[model samples]
Target: MGFTDDGDIAAYRRRRSVEFKHGRIAMLATMGFMTPEIIGHWPGYLSPSMGLKFADVPNGLAALNVVPSLGWTQIVIYFGLIEYSGGFEDYRSGTPGDYAWKALTSDDPEDKRRRLNVDLANGRLAMVAIMAILFQNGVAGTTGPEMWIPAL
Candidate 1:
């Protein structure tokens, strides 16, 4: 954004696009991290060839070390692919985060603007919430609803 003094439309669009992407990821991650604490992880192994069992994975960030090396590579490649799919040309000239997906996005201008605002706000909140959740899970050893009720 400092590249330009004002009217930096490209930077603005790119920033919004990034914010939405991070917001969505954070929302999903928070749910994934907390849901297991409440209802437990998947019933069985997620990767049979690697003998990786989601159900056996520990809660919170500690689970990161349990993933196989190939899984981490796959994750990195997947993210890279998604990022490449949204070419830089689109960010510079066209809609920044508009994947033009048929569902979830709105056609109305007002609704689109509102959704963008809320996405940024929620993303910022989720960024902080995730850190707090991680600290609590890793340090206090509490999760989900149990963190609130001492008797639980």
Candidate 2:
């Protein structure tokens, strides 16, 4: 008797799946590991004295380190949950779509969506704030591992 049992729900889920997929791809292209150059440049922009020679580093670990530590912790946590807890199965089984449909069909869908968006925005803002604070507190330096890890 849930949302997934409805025909309209299936169509809605399909549309949402496509939309989420495209949006994820676009976001990854701009902000995720897909664009190592951008990631490398972020730390430098935040604190030039970090001495993170991202360009000279043997591998791309510099960029990777900064991203995972700075602001992508939510993504890491989400991925870890999906990975270790088999949440990916839910995704494959259309649970997220069903949930999305249910949310959209709810009596207060607009309010729910607004709250969710605000939460997301707040999380992003918090990440940026953390990165800025870390940089300001002189926590933005490259360890020697960046240079040697690549050779191994």
Candidate 3:
């Protein structure tokens, strides 16, 4: 939309806003995928408190079966609360991912732009990496998103 039209920087920004949101989500998902493998087992209420030990859990798609219903419910509720509190106005307005943490923000515009570019690049790479991992697991006869597609 922006490429064909001159002086369409706003349109480009609106598209980039969607990219930024996806990038953030992919980054979070990438961390979640790796966290269990890195830590063996979470020390928090997600694992120990649920009577789940490090050995009891499996990595990749198999881990999804190990988690209890309550764990998923708690996660949904927690994130739901955050979403409800913040509302979707930021995303709707094409300015997403601002948690209002001033400490994490930079006073310099150039610095902020640089950091955002880095974040966007990293997130894009993470999205591709995670998708590749999922696809690899799917092809290996593992349980994952591929099961939902009959063609796969």
Candidate 1 Cα outliers beyond 4 Å, as residue runs: 1-7, 49-52, 87-90
Residue 22, model 3: Cα distance from true site in angstroms: 2.4
Global CA lDDT of candidate 1, please? 0.74
Q: Which candidate number has the best lDDT?
A: 1
Question: Which digits, one per residue and each the tens of the lDDT, describe model 3 over residues 1-152?
Answer: 34727766665665666676677778788777766655656544446677776567666777678888787789899988975885544445533444344453456777766777777788799889889777766678443444566772
Q: How do the residues 51-88 of candidate 2 rate in per-residue lDDT, one tens digit apiece?
A: 44445432223445563254467767887786587432
Candidate 3: which stretches are off by over 4 Å? 1-15, 43-51, 87-104, 141-152
- TM-scores for all candidates? 0.78, 0.29, 0.65
- TM-score, cand. 3 vs. native: 0.65
Weakest lDDT window of 10 consecutive positions for candidate 2? 38-47
Q: Candidate 2: which stretches are off by over 4 Å?
A: 1-83, 86-107, 139-152
Highest TM-score against the true fold, candidate: 1
Ranking by lDDT: 1, 3, 2
Count clashing residue pairs in model 3. Answer: 0
The candidate, 1 or 2, that scores higher on lDDT is 1
